[model samples]
Target: MFTDEVVDSVSIQSLWRKSQQSSQESRGCQTRVVHSAEAEAQTVSATISCTQTEPQYQATQQLFPNHDELEPPGLKDFLQRVEDTVIRELVKNAKSHAFDGFQVNWEDHSQLVSCLHCLQHPSAHERGLHVTSVSWSCTGSVIVCAYGRIDDGDWSTEGSCVCTWNLDRRALNPKQADLVIDVPTAVTALCCHPKQPALIAGGLYSGEVVIWDTSRTQDPVLVQTGMSVDSHREPVYQVAWVPMQKKGEFGVLSASSGGRVLIWTVDSDQGRLVLNSAYALVRQQVPHSSSSSFKVSLRIRENTVTNQSTLSEMYFRLKTMLVHVLSLSLSLSGEVQIFDLGRRSLRPAATIEQGDQGQAATCLAFNCQNPHLLAVGKTDGTVGVWQLSTDLTEQSPRESAQLEQIANQVAE
Candidate 1:
């Protein structure tokens, strides 16, 4: 999936404080990935050596009980410890392997590095700026920004807008955005189309999902609302595009804070992009005529209708496809729940209880190199890595081979 520009070697630099003795003291760490000339080598490794200059402090506070505090007191201390541990681990791993080595002078230098570019909103609002979400286009040429924050006092959707910038043209023309669409609701989540760079999906605070065509951003290309169809009641927190299962079909999955996940499909019919189907994330018990305890409610076009057996069957079909769905939810009590959209029950497949000391997970990401490896970041700057294991027999031979290849590359 990488183009020549992307496959080229790149260097990454991380900045951190040099020691606890001084808050102003800073150091830069850089790592470069270069291609090896050996035909037999599929991967290359490097060893970096850096001297530690400062003493680390110990954690002074105990882990707070879940019910004992609304906010954790030891969070800052815990984060500092995590940072020191990370630096130590990086140095250790760099020295353990040897493929090629280069020296970088870490001596403190006081000089300014030129900023390559900058992006800003065309119009400023009375409210403070809080870019809650951002996503890059598939080709990496465009960037989409969403604006809003629940914590912002006097927050309103009046200033909330979705803007896309063309990186290639920005250097030559820095005054205006490539595309700007005023959204009615505060955009909380954004996801670019995996196949189409021009299509951008945005989730709003009003529980609406709007798809904007960046090519012409004055208005949204498609809008899905809860009033017209089934949707989330709470703010949509995340929107992600699912891998396409069929040819000429596009699927998107969105998750809201109200514990709702909706799978939406879009298709072009008669030269118009239309919503083909929307399946709500819900659970229903199989109905029995002899039992009179069956109750059903569905929202349709601003009206709620009560029905029983048919809707239950529809939910059953949705549950059957849960294997392809991976939804994550975090509780204020420091619990992380992973829901399987393919399961028949609404209960989570696995739950990670963060006993007293931990805070709610703030972010989550799956490893591109290994899909089964998941990493979550907590509000306190603590990160947890979880491995999603499956039976060996469950994986096809092609998948098994790919896993083995990745293992060999890591070993190298």
Candidate 2:
């Protein structure tokens, strides 16, 4: 590197002091008025550079810090220091009951019941299509209805429609639905997704299981089980959503009068339902036992049974009991069968005769909030609500022993 030198002027001060010598001596010493001295007018100067000459070094820091480096010093000590204080605060909170009496009772709970809203689709009604199945969304704010010919036994080319209504909407329309999905055939069963608010599964009269995403405006069809070997040969009476092995993915469980209950995984890209598992519930395999006649029929009615797949808090072990609402359309006794899945025997654990004992039951459902409340629909287009006795839902040693004795006898 080339260096440049800068010259700067130096300043000097001249001083004079008063002297104690006589004026004569001062005059003799100061003989000349001005003194002149001549010599070489050059000065030697030294330049020193202050810039560092040592070699410069540069190093890059790592983008990600090591795990050991992330740990702070004396972490155990810090936690120990605050541990006592935290424990003390927690104990104090546990001893306190600030929210003990803040219970809110919002249920009307009146013995009297009333109708809220009767929703209908005008086009479906005009086409002589009646509702075959109805289901509520997981949020309990939306209701889905499947319209089909429940009375027609033969094959129908008539088109049907699925309708949904958002009851929470401010401008609720009873004569119209928020969303209407048209179907080529009658919809036999309808079930809303358990967790998803927009997903809906429907079983068609043609034995096709379809999943519809109401959120999609262009095409609500997410996936469908078209005419294939896996498809049911008869009308599907029930369709339910089941959890899949993968997280956040749901599969469909469909049952048909053809004695098959099939489970399918939705393949969205392929637009089809892939068969995952299948179960055959054949009515012909009914055991002709010498003691009891157990007519195990999957056909609850010509149409889908109301709440056929509903799980009750009775028998499936730890309140997972499944309530089998048997249809009595062919029987005059109008009996509803309660099958306890907790037991292996095919006999119903308990029999309930509610409403008109002679009337035939078309469908039935139990209230989820109250186990004692049961609603039964008759073949004569009548609905009856019955409140069961407390002893029926509760544990009775006498009933248990009686059932056990019967089971032992059957075994013998």
Per TM-score, the best of the predicted structures is 2
Q: Summarize candidate 2's per-residue lDDT along 1-412 as a digit string, tens digits.
A: 9899999999975443234333335333445587689887888999987866444332223444556665787997999999999999999998997644333334332321323554667887566565576666777677677777767899887888888877679998878889999888988887888888899999999999999899998889889999887679999988889888898888898989887777888776787888876665655655555522343434222122233453211111111223222211223466665543333336544455544466555444444445555544443323344555453355345446655775585555
lDDT of each: 0.55, 0.65
TM-score of each: 0.41, 0.49
lDDT per residue, candidate 1, 1-412, as tens digits?
Answer: 8566545688975455445445666789878987677555467889999887443332223343346556678887889879988999999988884433222324221111112334446452234444556666776656666766545445355547776666667354443556778766678888888778888887888777777776663556664544444667778888878765687667666777665556666644433323333334334633545542334333321112333223322221211111234456666555666654333346665666432454554444443334454444343323344556442113544445656774585455
Ten residues in sequence with the least summed lDDT for candidate 2: 311-320
Checking candidate 2 for backbone clashes, the offending pairs are 315-321, 316-321
- In model 2, state the lDDT of residue 376: 47
What is the TM-score of candidate 1?
0.41
